[model samples]
Target: MTPPHATPVGPDLPMPFTHAGVDQLVSIWLAQLDVIRDLAEELTAEQWAAASPCPGWSAGDVVAHVLALESELHGAPLTDHEPDWAALPHITSDFGRLTERAVDWYRTKGQDVVVAELIEITAWRRDDLAHAWNADSDPNEVVTGPLGLELPRERLIRTRILDTWVHEQDIRTAIGIPGGLRSDAAWVCAGQFAFGLPYVWGKKAAAPIGATLDLTVTGPGVSFERLVQINENGRAEFIERTATPATVSLTLDWPTYAAASAGRLNSDSTGALVANSCRGDDQLAARLMPALAVTP
Candidate 1:
């Protein structure tokens, strides 16, 4: 029998936002908001100003970005502040510059103002999600994502959960307050990484036909194993169970894997965290590094 706490992978596992419904996604998002709120409540002004793991983003800036996104989701207009994009070398696109301006604006407001805004906006968002997902809303209905593409509403929720949890970790890392590893939000973030493995294995890594790769991720409250195999059709697919031995086996904790996949962790940091056996395919293992970064 499986252990009582085990989260089984494969077809037996409930599809995210399907069996448990959209409420699962909403709950994870809310939990992350709570984490941010608590951290905000405790943070000193000095802590807020400290730079986060995300380049060019201080801890306070990260919170401001979250507030801006939530405000947009709630149909609140962004502040009419235009930043000179040419002066900002770190900002590559119009969107990046837009967010930078929001962060800069919040930074000028001081710690109290920004923290209070986070609390208020997140509370409002929680209520909005509760009402929206109720009353005959279709989880699969197409919704506009941050990138301006239509995605299934459930898929959007999953993306939000991943993004929020990652930012929370970024804040924690910045302020030296690291404790969300056991939460449902963390698992949700980690689960989303599995969705990118097919692209990583087939397109990025270019695994040989019939080669299998196995990844085992461990964390405080969750542990999961994922397997990907290249098929005769020259495509990679996740298998529920595979009798064939894996050509490469990788072991890493969830946070490291999450950071690497999000492109937040450098290759040196990622290499330090991963314990792997390439099984005579060292070149293939090296190829896996770039593939690990699926988030933009």
Candidate 2:
């Protein structure tokens, strides 16, 4: 259960979107968009069926999820006029139809039309989110999910930012986009991801008191927490952080960290992690190796 306004990670301080932050967010947004746009350039019936990072989800399912979320944020389907209960099957069936129609439409139309359709959806998503978030609302409004938490407006916006960022990666990887993420979106898009640390780590502390961990990335953009990740078998992990009093610290370049979270590193170079501030780099890296299979 998610609180209507509950912050994703936890209640960390909110920072105003600086000029640099805004630029990074846009870059991330557009870069992901570019990948999807580029892929739409030449998707065959089979490519659309390719598997994504997420289990049981293909490129098509990922796109459907995006459309569902964006539509939910500001459309009648998720309207305030609903009965106080989630229309579970109804929602799934409805969106299922949407996805089927979209795929059929993709198969039916010219490449130009497909691009136009995606552009329209993205434009609408941007407009709706901007309108809802940019407005003045009580930060403590009852917008939380069933989770007993309430996040401010900025925090909610961060989720949308993340959805776009991560899902784009889903699409990119499916199409075999080379290299790491081209934009500084990781920095810009991580507020919500960072907000989830407490929830992800829970009350568990992996590091000793006053331990030092440094997280650095070679990217040109604003700074936010880098994306947080946990390993597949649930032992290894990656987190965005610097040396400080905390548990489990690791360091990697921003894009590499992001790509590392995806699966492997770009330069075949592994990152360093200090576990209990005791394990050697190789061992620490060994610990964090399996989180790449995480689904969004």
Question: What are the per-residue Cα lDDT tens digits for candidate 2 across 38-108?
Answer: 56546665666677765445676566555545445445243222221243232345434443443333434
Query: Clashes in each model (backbone N, CA, C under 3 Å)?
Result: 0, 26
Candidate 2 residue runs with Cα over 4 Å from true position:
1-42, 76-120, 135-151, 179-184, 190-205, 219-249, 259-296
Whole-model lDDT per candidate: 0.74, 0.44
Model 1, residue 94: C-alpha shift (Å): 4.2
RMSD of each: 3.1, 10.5
**What digit string (tens of lDDT, one per residue) describes model 1 on residues 1-296?**
11234553442353233343677667777778777888878888788888898887889888888877777787776677766667657788666776687777776788898888888988898888888775356888998765355899878887888888888888888998877776777666766787788899889889899877887766555567788889899889887656666877776676777777888877776555443523436667777866798776
- Candidate 1: deviation at residue 214, Å? 0.7
Model 1 ranges off by over 4 Å: 1-18, 84-87, 147-149, 241-243, 271-280
Of the candidates shown, which would achieve the greatest lDDT relative to the real structure?
1
Instruction: Tally clashes: model 2.
Output: 26
